[model samples]
Target: MKTFIYKKYSPRPNILHLYEHVVSIHIHEQLRKMGYYCYVDYAIKAQTHDQGLATITIEVYNSMLETEWSDLLLWNFEITDALIQIAYYQFLAEEGVLFTVKNANLKEELEVEHSNGWQTTKNIDTPKDISGKDDTALVASSKDIPLLSYDIVLNFQKKEVAKESYHDALLTLGHNIQVHLSNKKGYYRSEFSVIGNEIKLSFQVIELLSNTLGQSDSLIATGVIEELIESEALDVFIDAKKARQLNAISISTFVA
Candidate 1:
């Protein structure tokens, strides 16, 4: 199998660490839904207290079914997009920006950001003070401040690749992965390469203090093997093998 390595460095190591944890869980859950088995061999976080930087190493395993490579790449793109959305949402939530459901009519009233690229809109309407105790007071003040909402969009650009720049293509892929993963982790340095069939991904984050969050194993095994065994063809194969053994025994008894 071929292998690819993607690395990144983050200055704000703690946030980056949390982002990786969230992405790892999300990607595994997504792959499982598509009938693919993914395993994390290891995720190690090395932090330098004096330097305030943390390095993370993550190794993932897959069955390497060639037929699913395209799907894998597409999902990789989706994973990047999802991470960006989640990071933006978390940021807004942290800033006390209340986000509501997407309203079609709000686009007409407010300046909606274009969907073609990464954009964030804040305070679609007036922010309301909803922390009132009296129901009458709340109702009276509701008209003074309206509920607020926000929109975030990120788009991926398509590029043609020449045979000479295959390595560059891998680098771009690695960058995309790192950008989404780095939003919370903080930015530092990163690298990406596709070596044989195996893909190795790693990153480093700088933290103010020390942490032990990334040292634990967070892999969950899938039941693809059991599912395959329960298929109709496998049942037929098992039945046929049993019948063949019985027939051979009967022939030997007659010969005796």
Candidate 2:
């Protein structure tokens, strides 16, 4: 079982928060129909437009399956595409409001801007369970979609005590970031709230990697993993550009 929630805060004198409210409602409905359990519980701090805040709680309960959980995450990533479509024609939708599904690569971009370095790569392999079902097959059979790999890149501004420290930091950052992208929580302010801040990350998952990259899997999976202990077959990145280059495929194996 996973419990997800989001809190939105805006200074006084901003009516834009209302737009965030509407987007939240829109997401809630879509998530529920997708088969994962979801709902919204809000915490409002003020009555006026200028200084208001909203927080929504979304939770998912899973039993004995990791693939379903991962598929739920893929659904969350697609929600951004859904928002872009919704904000275009909704009566109350505001202009210049954009939201992006945050991913590991997004964090790498920010770290680069801030003089910190980071890298990311995606590896789509069939990790199997005792039952012998690969993640892709499992997700597809359940939701009629496929599953892919998602990994992160981390660069340091200053030499730290060890690479392990940076690795640990990236791991925590990954968990916190994945929550919002997956729509595990409510709307964070307009989509722009996500697209525009260091508080958020930038990453892209396309429906078709091959169509966009014009490269085959055999050609791209060069030098993907460096460690002997790592078992996620098909290293997706050989370096920075290599790691960031990936197609965001819809995953169905992750929903419970």
Candidate 3:
């Protein structure tokens, strides 16, 4: 279990709301497609068990390649790597959608990985009104995966010989060029190879008891609160092996 936290100053003077949400991403699903297929059974999940704070947890059930070192040392790093990819590729620059990992386990887990690899601002002050939905899906190129190489193919062709409408013809095809077109007086056989990523995102709502709300105090906020109060939705980016940066949240307090 882990906790995540984000805060928003309310219209009420001296009153603020700390938002909470727990998200889970199926990291292996995308990693497997990237040929990152190594790991036993395990799980990654984020939680906001406490108000104003969130935590990321990675639990490995087993592994095939057990080295002399602690199994967690290597496996945890593997998970962190995926988490970083998820953060940069999908959630960078999302205004007001900032939070942090509120657990020591994640810190200890990071010792095996990178230090402070997953960090975000403490609060968000976006537009007075916003829109969003509670959906999570794959992002092409992860919308941010650094290009590895050519992922598109384009070509051009011209007709040769009077009968075939082509007086002269030449064709070339290689690793980059897949086809050559030679037809009509002139023609173009060009297209791009998109380096698509099937990385997907999902959302989860944190339901905190509202009866404890105080006038001059702050409490854990939920999507429902944001939607009802701000008329906007929020997408929080988090990192856990199963870390999920909840997708567009519902557009009202009931849904937020």
Q: Which candidate is the best by lDDT?
A: 1
Cα lDDT listed for each candidate = 0.29, 0.27, 0.23
Ten contiguous residues minimizing lDDT sum, candidate 1: 247-256
Ranking by lDDT: 1, 2, 3
**Residue 109 in model 2: shift from native, Å?**
24
Tell me the spans in candidate 1 whose CA falls farther than 4 Å from its real position: 39-67, 70-256
In model 2, where do residues sit more than 4 Å from their true spots?
12-16, 37-51, 64-256
lDDT of 1 by residue, 1-256 (tens): 3233222233332233333433444444454445443222212232222122222232334334333433233124333444544443333323233333232332221111111112122212222322223222102211222212211111222223333333333333333333333343322223334452212334333221114213210110012223322322122223423212211000000000
Over the stretch 81-193, how does candidate 2's per-residue lDDT look in tens digits?
Answer: 34533322221222222323233332232222223111111322222222222212102112222222222222223322344433333332233333233232221222211
Q: List CA RMSD, all candidates.
A: 21.7, 21.8, 24.4
* Backbone collision tally, model 2: 22
Each candidate's TM vs. the true structure? Answer: 0.26, 0.22, 0.20
Please give the range of 10 consecutive residues that has the lowest summed lDDT in model 2. 191-200
Report how far residue 225 has shifted in candidate 2, in Å: 48
Report the Cα lDDT for residue 118, model 1. Answer: 20
Which is better, 2 or 3, measured by TM-score? 2
Give a tens-digit lDDT track for model 3, residues 1-256.
2122222222211001111110123332332233222112234344332122333444443332112213222123333444443332223212123333333343233332232223333333243432212111211121332211111222222212232111111110111111111010011112322111111111221122122112111111122122222321111111221112222222112112
